[model samples]
Target: MSWGLAVLQHALRQPGCPLCRLQREAEARYLENLLWENVNDPATREQWAAGLGFCARHAWQLQRLEARRYGDGLGNAILYEDLLQRVIPVLEAMAREPAMDPLPLHRRLAHVLRLPRSGDPEGIPGLQGRARCRVCRLGEETARAYAEWLVEGLGDAEVRARYAASDGLCLPHLRMTLICARTRAPQALADLAGDAVRRLQRLLGALREYIRKHDWNYRHEPMSPEERRSWIRVVAFFVGEGEGDGSLDDRGG
Candidate 1:
């Protein structure tokens, strides 16, 4: 089977957001590749040149990961030292640019809302945006590709069965899948979403039981393992996996 199909199959058996897990794993592999083999690679360096390396979140994540694993953080030093050499001059240049006269807050808001800037209607300066992380861009690309592949192959009995039997897609993916299915297979898509709703209702019942069983009147009752993990799963259901610290090590840098 193709890699995307393999990921779908593997994801079926896993709890939490499969797309999140896939992206997290992809990011981990990317970081490992960068640290072990690509740090000094000419092609990798070229990629970093455009964005001055990763976004702030990934930059810190990389530093923390290196510090956690190797203690030396030499990888971070090697990267950011080079990055700063590139960044500092550009920041200096930007700093040297004369400040524009402040537009009134109402005017700024109006301009942002696409209203005419009155005297300077055509060329009022807009807010400068930060460069996006290349890895993040790739992760989003791959996640959508995977989601689309799953939706397209829903005709296959094995694929449908596997998907139906799993814990169900997280909200973001469920929406994406439903949108993909809206025109092509509306009934099947509705059934899929209904199944997810029923599953969530069942989980909600278990969560209630978990809470009740913990009360003073029911202290002797033993909680099922599924009940015990419901808290974690519930949070993952909303926010996707890897939001919590346990997932930090594997999170996309």
Candidate 2:
């Protein structure tokens, strides 16, 4: 299927309900900006940070998106910090409330406490597994620091390269990538697994070279005709599969 036809099909498949359609459109716009905007731009960086610093559910979704692109678990840690900070105030306010049936708030608090915590530089131990709510303010500050890191870290080509160098993705991350990418490029998602396989191959090759060099080495490699053809075939499958098609719908995009 041609890209144009694929796009048209995707648009046609959009929900007929006015509110749902509008929400989907807005989400698409947001995702386009997130993927295409320069992370180095101050305003764009700030916007991205604020937009992504979501509640637990949305933060989990964002973390999944980052996991697919970066491969390493770094995005998970970053998002966990963001959620912890955001939940702190809400938890504190709840604490002040008369202690009647706090089940709903308790569930939220539990989610925050369940996050993986470690003393490793990469981990956020204070916020990750805390039983008490006292560290809520500290978590917020830590989240701000993480937001700054997100702005700075992603802009560093070396950091991005290092992230990509980690294991390409697990099954869960791959699924997250496909779902997040669908609104932006439905056709591309239709054949996501194949794309993932190819990407992993490319990264593996790069990793081999970087290991041999013992330095942060970068180079561009040319794809052979066969490789190009194979990729195009995968893309075509994604585009033509449409919504509710097993691979495109069930797995991710």
Candidate 3:
């Protein structure tokens, strides 16, 4: 099947956060590709060396995947040992060189390390202009592609039907879709906005019912499956799936 159709099929089957699922899958696929095929590639290693390596979350993600795949830390050691070999000298340089300004923490740190400065144009910042995550670059591309697929899929009858039937997009992706629709498909904006409203209303009703069922007056009433999971769904609606996990954004300033 075409990649778009495959993504649509997966999205339709997923109960919530199709875009999140696509992104997560894309990250996993990219990681796996790196582990199995590109770990030893010179070009890939060059990119990692330049980027100063992955952000904490992605770095740990690689180690976790490596452990699971090989049941040994061999891959992690190989990749990171090389990373350390390249990184040590730069860190030594940071330690040896004095800060440019006594208290320009950000600029001084960048200067000492010889890493790209803030607004360097050559480098993109991580959590807060800290350092760039290579995986984040991959993620942004995948997210944009999936978002475009969502916009384009709106033109197909089956795709629209599937979307209308499925749990609507999460708030973050909903925002993205609305932005895309504004320029790409104005009519879809109304339809999608209406769908989002109805979905939220439905979820609100479920949450209300869930709360009501817990009251002494209605304690005897049994909760439906939807009402039982209303709390989780409501949280996911606001936070975006997987975002609540202790990711770099959550931990970083």
**lDDT (CA) per prediction:** 0.67, 0.40, 0.72
- Cα lDDT tens digits, model 2, 1-253, are 4443333234324322111222234443443344445334555443433333444433444455556666655535643455557557545756687573454444544475433222334533333333322122223333333323322332345533443443223343345445555555554454445545776576456445544444434235544433433333243233322222332223321
- Please, what are the lDDT tens digits per residue for candidate 3 over residues 1-253? 4698777667767666778777777887888888888988997776665566777878888888988897877766777787666456544544676463223434544555444455554433221324467787777677778777887787778788889887778898888878888986987888889889999999999999999998999999998888887787877788677543533123221
The alpha-carbon RMSD values of the candidates against the true structure, listed in the order shown, are 7.4, 18.8, 6.2
Best-first order by TM-score: 3, 1, 2
Candidate 2 weakest ten by summed lDDT: 15-24
Poorest stretch of ten by lDDT in candidate 1: 121-130
- Highest-scoring model, lDDT: 3
Give the C-alpha lDDT of model 3. 0.72
Write down the worst ten-residue block by lDDT for model 3: 244-253
Where in model 1 is the C-alpha error above 4 Å? 41-57, 67-72, 90-129, 243-253
**Model 3 lDDT, residue 177, Cα:** 79
Candidate 1 per-residue lDDT, tens place, 41-155, comes to 8877656654557876666667777877778777777877766665454345445653634244325444443322343333332221134576777666666777776776676
TM-scores for all candidates?
Answer: 0.71, 0.25, 0.78
Candidate 2 lDDT score at position 246: 36
